[model samples]
Target: MELRQLAVFVAVAEELSFTRAAARLSVVQSAVSAAVRTLERELGAELLIRSTHHVALSDAGRVLLPEARATLAAAQEARHAVEQQRGGLRGTIHLGILQVLRDHPVSAARVIAALHARHPGIAVEPRQAGSAVMADDVRHGRLDAAYLALPSQQAGLTLHGLSEEPMVFVCPPDHPLAGRAALTLADVAGEPFVDTPEHWGTRIFSDLAYSAAGLAREIRYEIGDLGGVAAFVQSGLGVAILPPGMIDPVASVTTVPLTDAPLFRISLAVPAGRPTGAVTRRLVETALELRDRTPTPAG
Candidate 1:
């Protein structure tokens, strides 16, 4: 009938003696007897058998022991959950964002704004990183979470795919194939290519696409700076393969669809096999909400 009564019943059931149960609960024996009598009357069943020499459970007591224990455990868990909520999601979330996502700054801002408005106690520190390093940073504790372009499997991280951004080929307007609707990686295999460094997230997918096509890309320039890749292609330095949304709109550079380009899958990656902190969980939820509401590609 009541949590205290159930707790008292459990103690008596386990100990099999009111005197022992009272001692275990640090209460007087008569008080324990009175509590059990009240519980039995409420349940309309006798719960214990008592004789001068021994104490034993009646049928009702045996049947209710496990259920009583369960009720107490559930009540304790409920209290813990409330206490945790009262504590607030108050902490710093060491977050990392992919350099390419910087192109869609509004989505990033919206996620942070929603998180802060709902849980003002959470502080977000966002830093830019190449997709290749985002997963490793999160797994190694250098970051709490990150928006990453993850490979199919990351050993020590959990990846939640948010959006798939298509890749395109960027070439100077005068390039022979610039006006084409779409072309495969093989078509541009021999062209002078401006690409990201080998360690970049974009480079990983590009390399896999080229490898699948059995094409050896002629990388004329490998840019370390994220902005330099588009700059090089726009200046007639070389053709580049990149997410169309990530590239700044340039009249001099024509974005041709790539038939075989791999779609960049953006995901929220967190360390695997650990309890996520309250603030980190809130960030993940907000990011998911934003991801679902935003369009995949920029107009």
Candidate 2:
């Protein structure tokens, strides 16, 4: 079947509405319907079952959707490959980085600068985003690569470990436990805590660490980022457990090692099972080189 027909089928399968798919493709509904019909006739299978009130994918459609997407991606990659061969590694890489990792060592800026210096034709657009969302973006081809915590096991993605920073306890300098040599989640079980929202990667690490220690963290305030968390903690609003790299240098806030905290792993992840473009490969190599040069944070 033609790639155009497959594209229409994929659009219809995803939107589940001929009208919506037409709008998405910027074509008329009749053109979309005719394309799907042509694809169905060529494949000798009914891809979708449409009714007056509802439209759903048939078993054949469900089976072909992923294959269709892969085919389309491969075709796009082929075109990109030709363009790169002619122009020498010229393209924009949509990259995502965790907000906290921007200025730290092995930072996104370092990676982008290295890539740019090596290949000025390569354009890098960096966006600060949450790790979970970034992982999904990489998996779906929305992002070429991302610097963030790797998902435990996300399909269609490859994660390369960069560095693992230990989580630490932060409290006001005058707090009773601030002077402790070492602490655990249980040490601050009853203390007010300030941290990011539940969807944050740090929050996931905190939840898992506390659960493992059989202690419940009383998150008194939910801050959007580590800067806000540091502000709240320094103001005596609550204590916080955060990556050592995320700890602020505020004179009034002290960071203590968590004796039983999870390591905040930073990884460079990319979409799996696809030919990575030249610019994206250079970016990944730069990140790996930086990771080698940087030391892991101690607890």
Candidate 3:
């Protein structure tokens, strides 16, 4: 029932490995095991199913994981509140940033810079990953907040729209579709496309767009970053549909507007129904303020 025991159990439940959880908590493996055992003894039920090589959460663990996270979050919020009243906020915020947005105006760098200027005591730890991974990290309490490109509604998370731009088609200068003023999904249905992996935010958005139009395109090249996608297109490997500003002008590629393309949106995602600590709240506010001040990139 102790907060320390609950914290240890939650770490093990999330990592699903005693060694890894201990490493994350900066404690020894035996200490982590002892804490989990003490928590199970008090709760009267086994929380984790442990084996020599693997660890899995039992039904009881599954039921307690979310509650444990909420409890820990509440306790942290209480501490942050008292600290804020005393002088200023001081805590580390684990933040996730989408790789595609590394060059964008309202990127993690700008947001972190602004937040730091306001609160010198707060520290931000930025992790770069795809939007889907970032969203899952936020939902599972691995990250305090993340910049994500996702649909309007995601389970167990809240998304705040920051910027939106229409998706555009990019191809080699001599490609057939490059001469067109605009394109529809059907126009590119049979062509080979260069796209990110299926889990990436841009890929997910394009998939939904094609599905809505009852069309499917072949993904010929799978690149992890927008720059690489542009390179593949410039080399005549395949065409791509990406957000504005993603395909640099220096690349010998042509960008054509889509007639009814899906909007590529960037949003701020946080865990739903959880109390926001003072540090996290201030960071969110600063991000929103900066987003409003920055101009939207042209499509």
Candidate 4:
């Protein structure tokens, strides 16, 4: 009636002895005997006749042996088919991303291109959102994976952090620090700053950078988009502390390091304990690889 029962029946039928069958099945002989007895009781018939000296199949046992073997084979096949996905050679996968990566641009497009090139049937589903919202998407089934600048460390969540692109100070090209060979946070500490919305991860990075320099950032404007903040700085409105990813090399704006800002890393957020498919795995790898093309710290 059950797969295990069928396996036991086949083993006992082949071995013609419960002891050999239990040893082959790695179970006690009494367990094998009890299983055979249960199988017979379920069928309302005895399938084997055993004595102190010999064991042989009864008429019912002979009738059921072939069917039991066939059933076990079918069960094995079904299990194998169900497990084929684990081999990690195919399948479509979903991916999510923050609306803006700290310093990476169109991060999904690069990952998608790489996944499609290697695996034919694979595709990427991208969701653009803030780090807070994206974190939830990865937790729920809505997203297969995501990129997070800063995310809450929750159970059932996994992270693969790729690189650290710390927040830096930016100003109009005509500003005093813009003409220097290198600049520091102290250079712009006295000026009004374009700051993150003072809510979460991005904000913490900017604040820490200035705090490390022994100065509180003079944030004059607080907005969500770093690119927009850069544009505001380019207008000579004020100098700002911005992440390396947020700047697109706008001609009028110049970016400089904040002396010793805490490294704001970019991490790939995935649901913990869920199996990763081939496409999803490659996409994360591609994102890590992209980091090489970005600026590296001064040696």
> Tens-digit lDDT track for model 3 on 1-299?
89999989988887789997898789999999999999999999999998989999999999998798789888998888888889888999999987753468668788899989888899999998888888888876788899888888999898878888899988899998889989988888789999998878899899999999888889999999888898999999999999874666578999888998888888888889667677888888988898888877643
Residue 72, candidate 3: C-alpha displacement in angstroms = 1.8
- Relative to the unseen true structure, what is the C-alpha lDDT of residue 190 in candidate 3, on a scale of 0 to 100? 89
Provide TM-scores for the models: 0.68, 0.81, 0.89, 0.58
Better of 1 and 3 by lDDT: 3
RMSD of 2: 3.7
**lDDT tens digits, residues 126-193, model 4?**
76666666666666445668777673465667887655665676788888787676666666678888
Among the numbered candidates, top TM-score falls to: 3
Compare candidates 2 and 4 on lDDT and give the better one: 2
Q: How does candidate 3 fare on TM-score?
A: 0.89
Q: Residue 268, candidate 3: how far off, in angstroms?
A: 0.9
Please identify model 1 stretches exceeding 4 Å from their true place. Answer: 1-87, 101-106
Q: Give per-residue CA lDDT, model 1, range 106-210, as digits (tens).
A: 255678888989878778999887777767667645577988865668797898777776788889888899889999888888899888877677888788888
Q: How many residue pairs collide in each prediction?
A: 0, 0, 0, 1
lDDT per residue, candidate 2, 229-297, as tens digits? 889999999988888776665536998887787888888888886567666778888888887887766
- Clashing residue pairs in candidate 1, if any? none
Query: Top model by lDDT, which number?
Result: 3
lDDT for 50 in candidate 2 is 92
Q: Best to worst by lDDT, what's the order?
A: 3, 2, 1, 4
lDDT of 4 at 184: 65
* lDDT of candidate model 2 versus the reference: 0.81
Pairwise TM-score winner, candidates 1 and 3: 3
Listed per candidate, the RMSD to the true structure in angstroms reads 16.0, 3.7, 2.6, 17.0
Say which prediction, candidate 1 or candidate 2, comes out ahead on TM-score: 2
